[model samples]
Target: MSWLALFFLGTFTGLLAGIFGLGGGFLLVPLLSALGIPVAEAAGTSLIAVWFSAIAGSSLNWLKDKFDGGKSFQIAFLGIPAAQLGVVVSNLFPDRLLKLIFAVLLLGMIYLMNLRQQLSEQETDIKLAPSPPTPGATGRKFYWWRYASIGAVSGFMSGLFGIGGGLIMVPLQLGFLAETLESAVANSLGAMVAIAASGLIGHAWRSEVLWIPGLCLGAGSIFGAPLGSYILPRLPNGLVTTAFRLLLLILSIYMVRASWASGWV
Candidate 1:
């Protein structure tokens, strides 16, 4: 029954991830908890599942020319090391404290999403012009540092929360790198592949992953990713964004309440 539940959850999560280019850990963590797994265990298992799902989804996108391999690699290089550091830090925190922190982070994320939506609604549309050709040594250094910094932060979040870091990466890319939302989403997934991979390695070394459940979820996600990618491009961006934000808000509230009830607050 637990395996079946994991399979279904993974399918659903993968669909959302493929469509939105998310890490899918948001769905996995709650589903695992509902299945009676310990919170930290659930997080660790979900990270593994998310890594496979990201790979599958990214592959699908790559076939469609939606992925940027160079950008992805640059981000991954920095993010993987940062994720390792995050795992070390996570090990130092108590489980209850971690859960409380996760709850708080989720709430903050919900608020940020709302703020972004409101601000975007009020903003005038500005057309983006073509980026000027990079000039010699100056351009390369600037972009290298920028990409590395983004990767490190994203990686750290992945390690701390066992997430793929799309929730953080997408916004950062859009806001700081001035990338298009679609591009950011795609690129974020690419970066997540590396972050998740590194995190999984750390978790494995720490004996934190549950292989059976993770594999079950990954199996279902493999099928779901292509389906989500197929449906995503046809949907309206505003509608999709609204739906995602609402879902996150509901989940955040639920998680907060759950943490409180568990005396982790």
Candidate 2:
């Protein structure tokens, strides 16, 4: 792809990433593959792009006091190592298989997001209704396992698929941690910085990255990430959730067809 084309692609990807706390890799890898880049190479390139976008978005989150430092660190601690292992495992798969895997993952994510939305709605309704106060059942207990599990799973997917892991992280935070959507998004972006960096190192060591393309994409993301962050807080919670699910639905359909195309493979 031309530098200009890559630049524009990165900008669009970054915009969405900023809004949704994604690393943009979920979209980037498949889109690059569609543009005729090899799947493995696309995945590797996406890590670089994700790294930049995460840094950009995370920085803004921090500046805006939207970050949860302790929680983010807990996720990154396990995520960093898990990401390296993921890269090793990815080398065992052929591009055709990887494409199919990615498609399936997208479909699964759509279901998960939908489930999260429903759960969020239920939680909202429960909060709105009056309830008897419980004396000793404070919901503020910290759970290390929760963060560790989130990190490991998200990190592994990041390495395997070249995504920022926000797809997994945000939903899990909301479901298990009772984080608001905006807070979950901010925390997800924060954790992605280290996770994406670790994945990028592994991909680079394998010589799978296209540096020029990745750099151009990264540069564009730096410009777009802030704009996305700005818009997220202004949007309604339901609208944001709906948009996320819809986007995933569309992408999943496109990925299924692309992965099944024998000629493409």
Candidate 3:
């Protein structure tokens, strides 16, 4: 039954990965821990699910003509090193401290989602929208500072929290990188492949992962990912953005509750 539950979780994560290009760790860690898995172990195992799901999701995006390959690869190049570094750094922190930090990140995400939602509503009335690409906002072009910053921060967070940084990446791409919801999600999925793999390597080195659970999760994700990517391009941007924000909000609340229960707050 526990394995079945984990499989369901992975299925959901795979869907999110396809739709949002996130590593799906935002919800996985807390849920796993709540199911009696240790924090580090949960993170480690989650990375495995993230890696497989990301592969499937990203592949789907490519087939669906939803991805920007060059830009995505550029971000991945910068994110890879940063992700590896984050994995090393995460082990140095106490589990309780890490939970607190993760909780804080969740709060920040919720705030960002709300802000973006408001701005989006406002923009709907503007009428003339060329996406008004900022002078150097996120896009096809390589904005060194922008990509570098996102890579470093999201990668580290991905490693630290075992989140594969998709949550952070999507919003950052939209807010600062000057991406639409669609492109942000596509690029984010591309980046998660590297970020989650780096984190998984670190965890595997420490023998923190449970192969049975990881395999079960990966198996479920295999079926869910393609389905999600298939649905992504068909959804309205506003609907997709709303769903993303709501998902983050729900996950943030869950993490906050878990942190409090664990006395990490």
Candidate 4:
């Protein structure tokens, strides 16, 4: 693709990542495939893009005090190694099967997102408070072990499917740490940087990244991320999750259809 095209893709993906706390790999992978990259190659290239975008977005969040660096770093240490392991496992699987699994997983996540949103909305008077850092309640007493386990799971999914794993991470944080949704989103974006970086390193060793396009996408994300992050705080949690879930559902269906049509199923 032309440098201009790559730049625009990067910018757009970065903006989305900043706004949604996504790695933006879900969008990047499909875009790369449409540009004629092989499935495995596209996944690898997408990881590079995701890494750049995550770094740019997370930096902005950090500067704005939207993320805690100490906490994020701890999670990354756990996630990064696991991400490499996931990349190795992905390399072993057939691309077609991998795509199919990704499609199904996306569908499942969309459904779960929707369910969570609905439940949140139905409980009209539910209190929205920042969870206290307590042993049994907050899981902070076992922070290292809990975050490490979460990071490992998230990293594996990210490497296997070329996704940011925020969809998984945010919910896990909410369930385990009892974090507010916005806090979870911010922290997830920070965690994604480590996961994407590890995956990119693994893919680079395999010569699977398309540097030009990946860089282009990264450049765009640099500007767009702050804008998205700015908007995230103003939105209601239920509304944000509902919109995100709907978008995921639509994207999931499109992926399923495209895979079937391509006989990759």
By lDDT, the best candidate is 2
* Ranked by lDDT, top first: 2, 1, 3, 4
- Ten consecutive residues with minimal summed lDDT in candidate 3? 132-141
Q: Write the per-residue lDDT of candidate 4 for residues 1-265, one digit (tens) a residue.
A: 6888777877777666666656678777766766667666777777776776677767767788898766677667778988888778878876656666776887788765654455444333345435434346455558767777888888887776677887777777766765667676677778888788888788778887777777777777676666777888888866777677776777767666667766753
Q: Candidate 2, TM-score vs. the true structure?
A: 0.85
Residue-by-residue lDDT tens digits, candidate 2, 80-161:
9999988888899876778778888988887877766776676677668899232243533456667877999999999888
Residue lDDT tens for model 3, 138-222: 4335575576678778777776677767667766776676566667777877877877787788878888788898888887778
Candidate 1, 1-265: lDDT as tens digits: 6889878878888888777656678777766666666666676788887788778768867999999998888889889999888888878886656666776776666665654554344332533335433236657778767777889998987887787777777666656665666676678778888888898888778887899989888888877776787899899987887788777777777676666676754
TM-score of each: 0.84, 0.85, 0.78, 0.81
How do the candidates rank by TM-score, highest first? 2, 1, 4, 3
- Backbone steric clashes in candidate 4, count: 3
> Number of the top candidate by TM-score?
2
Clashing pairs in 2: none
Full-model lDDT for every candidate: 0.75, 0.81, 0.73, 0.72
Pick by TM-score: 1 or 3, better one: 1
Give the winner by TM-score: 1 or 4: 1
What TM-score, to 2 decimals, does candidate 4 have? Answer: 0.81
- Please report how far candidate 3 places residue 139 from its true position, in Å: 12
Candidate 4: stretches off by over 4 Å = 115-141, 230-243, 262-265
